[model samples]
Target: MSLCEAEKTFILHGVEENFRIDGREREDYRPMEVEIGIISHAFGSARLRLANTDVLVAVKIEVDTPYPEKPSQGKLDFFVDCSANATPDFEGRGGEDLATGISNSLSDAYRSSKAFDLKKLCIMKGQKCWKLLVDILLLECGGNLYDAVSLAVKAALWNTRVPGVKSVGIDGKNVELNVSERLNDCVPLDVSGAPVMVTVCKIGEYCVVDPSAAEEKCSSAALVVAVSQGNITTVLQGSAGSLHPTTLMDSLGLGVEVANQLNIALMETLQSAPPHFDVGFLK
Candidate 1:
């Protein structure tokens, strides 16, 4: 967690007036900064900062044999690494559990066929296919990790450019093809169903969105809602304690409403990002 009980009350009161601790409204998202194509070695890369939490996502595309069961489809894997820079508690593999949890959650969120189409990445029937590895690096943990990570993933995907295929020459004994010409060409991935995770903290019977560390500690429990295109993708209950059924439902509804607005703001921001935008850090 990131503030104190008094600080939380101040934030809550600000929210009640449609203002936030950062001087934004409940509907207004924190100033988001994005940087694309930052990694020269990776196929695509992006860095996103939402208030304090900073997340970097890089896309690495590789060629591999398609899975036997899903030969016609490609694969998109998600991996989250919790860097020790965020906190000392994550030192020496101590953060493995949390890292794995975040990665697995992302895999589940994108596993549905309807969420992300993989067939477009298939090159051969069962021989070769493109696999996209999405690696997420956590730079800071000032709170609101879920929202920040999801936004970074979406931006990285948008910046991704899959290498195009030149030609396919298959022989009975050995199959050899020429692909050098198409190495420079690339196609962008469609991320329309990119899901956003919204956390609704239940603090003294009131729900708070995007809580800071202190606000998180002040709350009894929280609900994690993954929403894609205004639809509920997944719902997870967090915090150290449990909650009443009615409160859970209320949190979910609030999350959905906030998620829709968040998605819209993200889309607008990405669209407005300039081609040669600068990375804003130390901010």
Candidate 2:
């Protein structure tokens, strides 16, 4: 990921000319591929590949008591694992820091009620609730990890189905519940307001979206912007660098615009996707 002076200069000149080394415009994203329902055991799963960046996400549900304060709402948790298969640098516990950072960012992005509704996951006022555990596995890393992870997580949640409750009864001091026996008797998660992240990288005086590995090395500063339903849910500054007030404002504008477009494209692709087949890394 290190770039020499000459390589950095080349990238800077290309950005100034509005053409990247990969032949992409400033706001253009690399080609993306998405697949859903890849994991049979999990309630829902999805895999996304943006160029060389690969991410897999799965959603698991467990019945548990709701928190005292938020008894009316369910729980959502994010976990990220950077597999060593992606890079030798991630072996052992080396990837823990990176994984924690990504998971924290996801939690912040989904914290707002406008971004995701936990009430739909609630089964009872205080006795019981469904806790969603979103697990993200990073299989490969080319660049733009934040954007790819967010998209994959959103897609997996969209594909998740919660089984319908057949009945809820109180027996003694315990709450009893029965779930539907039929496999098809389930409810799909609503993800219309799920946030999509866009990483804006600053090189020279220009800003670029979806930076490749080389582009990332040349960046002085970067911002990861999360947009949900045309509104910004979170803004995270990444790596080491400082930005002027005007430059930061401009980057925010660009990030929001790019994120909006990315969200639309992802939704269309998910809707038009055909019946699933075995198209994992083997493909």
Best by lDDT: 2
Best-matching candidate per TM-score: 2
lDDT of 2 by residue, 111-203 (tens): 998899999989999989999999999999999999999999988998899989999999887999899967789999989999999999999
Question: How many pairs in model 1 have backbone atoms within 3 A of each other, for residues 3 or more apart or on separate chains, i.e. clashes?
Answer: 4
Per-candidate TM-score against the hidden true structure: 0.87, 0.96
Give residue 114's error in model 2 in angstroms: 1.0
> Which run of 10 residues does model 1 get worst, by summed lDDT?
274-283
Clashing pairs in 1: 1-213, 2-213, 2-214, 3-214
Cα displacement (Å) at residue 196, model 1? 1.5
- Report the C-alpha displacement of residue 38, candidate 1, in angstroms: 1.3
Rate residue 57 of model 1 by lDDT: 90
